[model samples]
Target: MGRAPSDSAGGDRLRFLRSFLASPRKVGAVLPTSRRTVDNTLDLAPLEEARWVVELGAGTGVYTRGILERVGSDARVVAFEVDAQLSSILASQLRDPRLSVVSDSAVNVARHLDGAAVDVIVSAVPFTSLPVPERKQILRAARDALGREGIMLVLQYSPLIERELRQTFTYVRRRLSPLNVPPAFLFACQGDPRSPAGER
Candidate 1:
């Protein structure tokens, strides 16, 4: 069988640019997540034994593939992409029984999770570019969706949201990847133990 309409590499990049132009804040970058960014982000998450992994803003499946590669065969990956076009392409390109590509706002991620506690969440969402309220909302949802021992890895071009992440997660650590387009900051967060698993 041939690759789907959204499966072409050149076409994917062109569509990514159009999506970025349509919603700069949401798309965040003109190009997809770089290898260095993805590597640094996933390194913070314990993906080897992760049974449930959630990927936010999985633009072109860069981090999605990284997570999948490191996770066990029984692992389940829930990828949230607000852009329908990009989400469609992801659904086409990543056809694994373990993956679920949801076309929805990242703030509403918990709604699609069915009360499952996530083991790791690799977020490529642009926290710096989004409005403060949306940023808080999405972070809150992610916090609630995590298990007590869950880990969240957020990748951004700036450290603007480090304080915000600290507010949600009990233990927050930051790392920098200098090889990306504009370089990037990765925040590794461990959820507060007081919250119940999958409460959101």
Candidate 2:
């Protein structure tokens, strides 16, 4: 028989804790993201109409499951999880054909896109913990991978990413989810200034 919901949740939390303990900087959080934060993040994303969505740092598939619920049947979600064990767990647990789990870094997101236009990119990455160069590289890659009208939603524990985000995109908006553990700042960014459409 399948595990009870409570048991599943407990397992998820344990997995998250182990992953975080293994690589605090990469995993970012000791617990799974709160439902409120997930709702807030998805509310800002244009997922219903999105053909392709990318999730960065998809720990325990919290945001990934939420994205699947909102996106249409034809929509595809590419989830990047740096933790190998967590990635494997995510792939096995969420057996949806539309979801692709990438056991890799977000910096290589574009390579896996196959030239399809991405409508939304949801990032739960711990940018504050990464090296400056790596952070910038990942941001730049995400910017280039998106379509002209694509939007990138980022969830962070602090506003430190605002400056880097503004440097990459012409538009940036921030919101706060106070109920999340340690709370979180959500950023919606578009209009990559380096892109030709952004220049127009």
Candidate 3:
């Protein structure tokens, strides 16, 4: 018999805690993201019309599942998770052909894209915890990976990434999701004029 929904949820929490304990900086949060925060983050992304979507730091498949629900049947989602165990669990649980769980760092996102233009990029990455050079590298990769009309949606516990987003994208919009655990900031960014693909 299949596991009960509550059991599955419990397992996810346990796994998330273990991952966080193993790598506090990479996992960022002790608990998985709240559903409200996931909704707030996705609300700004153009997922319904997106052909290719990239999710950075897809912990426990919370936002990954949300992305699958919102995108069309033909859409593709590439979810990056730095933790090997989390990546493995997410891939096995979802088992959706539309989703690809990449066991790699977000900085290597561009390499996995195979040059396909991404329509929307959703990030749960803990930029504040990363080294400056690494953060900038990932941001640059994300910017260059997007198509002309692409948008990048970021959910962060702090607004520390706002300046970086503004510098990378010509248009950056911020919203607050206060109902989330610890409250969170959402950034919807587009219009990277410097992108080789042109303005977005």
Every candidate's lDDT: 0.85, 0.88, 0.88
Angstrom error at residue 123, model 2: 0.4
Q: Global CA lDDT of candidate 3, please?
A: 0.88
Per candidate, the number of residue pairs that clash is 0, 0, 1
Q: Which regions of candidate 3 are displaced past 4 Å?
A: 1-7, 195-198
Error of 1 at 140 (Å): 0.3
A best-first ranking of the candidates according to their lDDT comes to 3, 2, 1
In the predicted model 1, the residue pairs found to clash are none
Better of 1 and 2 by lDDT: 2
Best by TM-score: 2
Point out where model 2 deviates above 4 Å: 1-7, 196-200
* lDDT by residue for model 3 (1-200), tens: 12112217788999999999998987888888888898899999778899999999998988887888888888889999989989998888888778899999999998899999999999999998988998899998998898888999998899988998998898999999999888999999998867565456
Estimated TM-score for each candidate: 0.90, 0.94, 0.93
